[model samples]
Target: MFIAAYVLTGCMHQPEPVVTPIQQLNTERYMGTWYEIVRMPTSFQRDMSHATASYRLNADGTFEVVNRGFNTRKGEWKTAVGKAKPIDGMPAGFSVSFQWPFSGGYYIAELGSNYEYAVIVSDSHDYFWLLAREPRLPRWLIDRTLARAHEWGFDIEQMIETKH
Candidate 1:
């Protein structure tokens, strides 16, 4: 009796395994007040103070994000509202598209266990934010958060410590 051995070959072309997307945020709990502790500088908020963000979930299944800051130079409050949506399968991450259909990646990389603080990031990693429930965070918390940010590949030096 003669026995033959067969070899099996697998295709080299295989679809990349998809990363499990971030968790979708519970808008209700996410709503309320958030103070800016630090963020990547942007023209829109070049000169601002008392910076705060307020969110309200609309019945239409969208969040009404109101960003407010006091312009020291202008001596007035600046406010803007932009629609936000999840980027494909990213749950905790979203794309805040101020101009319809034009979106920018906004990812929530870390959040405080108590929902008092959160770290937001952009796809480019150039944009980042340290947000808290109050204008100032506890020293220990700030230090801990900063350490985590550094570990997460953020340029801690670039983070602008906000007054408000």
Candidate 2:
């Protein structure tokens, strides 16, 4: 009886699994300046204000990613240049790393039909961002994105609203 009870309790307390939708990323449409409207907090971006990311296709078939932001703590601007390459055998899937050799996932989970906004996810789904060309996105679109994120097992409440 004790063993059965313990097994049942463990099963009941099992964590929910994460599910992600198959991403259909259009590379041409995705290359542009994206204002970071919202994001998940990370150590690299801590104390950052007015953050933005830009992507451009390089002649050598790699992506040049530029991340810029103002460090409120340091009272100066911070910039980082990174290179990105598509994950093997995955369409529109990419991995990015900064000056260091280590890399991180850069999956384009959802993109606007008109290239107006994009939702990106990391391999673990712990990091996420909603980016757009302009700082202000339409309310309806934001709602739609949140709904989609929920469907994909992401906790939308964790999203941090950014000023830029």
Candidate 3:
């Protein structure tokens, strides 16, 4: 009776598995500026336009992220800074936080072979971002990437393209 009860309890309490990130990332190659192609809505990004995100490696082996964009309605440029620490066993995912003790999962689901583009999917599946090294990508590539994202179970239609 004790053994059966314990087994049943364990099965009911298992946590959801973490989504996998792209393997064997060259963090150095992944650094630098990436133009925001499209993104799923988030409170912080509401009312923003021409959005861009930049990454820089820190001496302490972490990373700094600067997200900037123009707020059309507000008629101003806005910027937000955050830091990310790499998660063990996940080469392309990090625990990112804009404020202390409040980190969120940042994972790269797909990346271009030449590091020209990347797709980031939040652990909660509530956020997604499509980014590229250039502000404008060829139409075919954008369509292809979005197709791939759809195959991977993300709602591609929910992503809104950025002006830049």
Q: Would you list the C-alpha lDDT of every candidate in the order shown? A: 0.63, 0.67, 0.71
- Give candidate 3 regions above 4 Å deviation: 1-19
TM-score of each: 0.79, 0.80, 0.85
Write the residue-wise lDDT of candidate 2 on 1-164 in tens digits. 00011111111121221334345666767887888877766777778778788889988768888888888899998888777777766565666766444566666667777888778776555667788888879888888888887787778888677765
Model 1 earns a TM-score of 0.79
Cα lDDT tens digits, model 1, 1-164, are 00000000112221111122237566578778889888766666778778887777778666666778888899998777776554556666555655553455556767777788877766554566778887899888877877877777777877777885
Ranking by TM-score: 3, 2, 1
lDDT of 3 by residue, 27-76 (tens): 88888998888777666777778888888999997988878888888999
Q: Whole-model lDDT for model 1 versus the true structure?
A: 0.63
Which number leads on TM-score?
3
In what order do the candidates fall by lDDT, top score first? Answer: 3, 2, 1
